[model samples]
Target: MDASFVIHGPSIKPGTEIELISNTDVAPTAAQLLSVEMKNVDGRVLTKVMM
Candidate 1:
């Protein structure tokens, strides 16, 4: 799979980087940032990027 990305957001720490095992993790990670719950999701929240 060709999986690579450069994500920038207010909650993301500057000059920080992380590796994700699956693209599915994106949805859960974004939900965490907004403090919302996503049903039927199997992805983990990306704690490393949270402010």
Candidate 2:
């Protein structure tokens, strides 16, 4: 997909302030699972799981 946008504003004088804002929408994706391992003082695999 394709899109375009534009914005306009007025000029500011001395000691004046102005603000411009824009917003966009985005889609979310699925999360991936991973395995984690733990070790003890003897350096041994304790358990593994997906997260």
Candidate 3:
């Protein structure tokens, strides 16, 4: 998630699904924090982050 997309006010519960739409490339550091592999819609590996 981008810095701008971070919600600072409340705690989000588990199982909550948030949709993120970004046109700009998400930094490698950010992808690592999210623990989700950054890839294109076609399943191409853009970056691999540890889960």
Looking at candidate 1, the ten consecutive residues that score lowest on lDDT are: 13-22
**Could you tell which candidate, 1 or 3, scores higher by lDDT?**
1
1 or 2, greater by TM-score:
1
Q: Candidate 3 regions off by >4 Å? A: 1-26, 39-51
Clashes of 1: 0
> What is the C-alpha local distance difference test score of candidate 1?
0.80
User: How does each model score on TM-score?
Assistant: 0.75, 0.19, 0.23
* Candidate 2 lDDT over residue span 1-51, tens digit each: 444423222321233322322222110001111233322322322112111
| Clash-forming residue pairs, model 1 | none
User: For this target, which candidate reaches the highest lDDT against the unseen true structure?
Assistant: 1
Quote model 2's TM-score. Answer: 0.19
Please give, for residues 1-51, the per-residue lDDT of candidate 3 as tens digits. 454443221233333444553534345335545566666542222222222
Give the Å shift of residue 3 in candidate 3: 16
Off by over 4 Å in 2: 11-51
Error of 1 at 18 (Å): 1.0
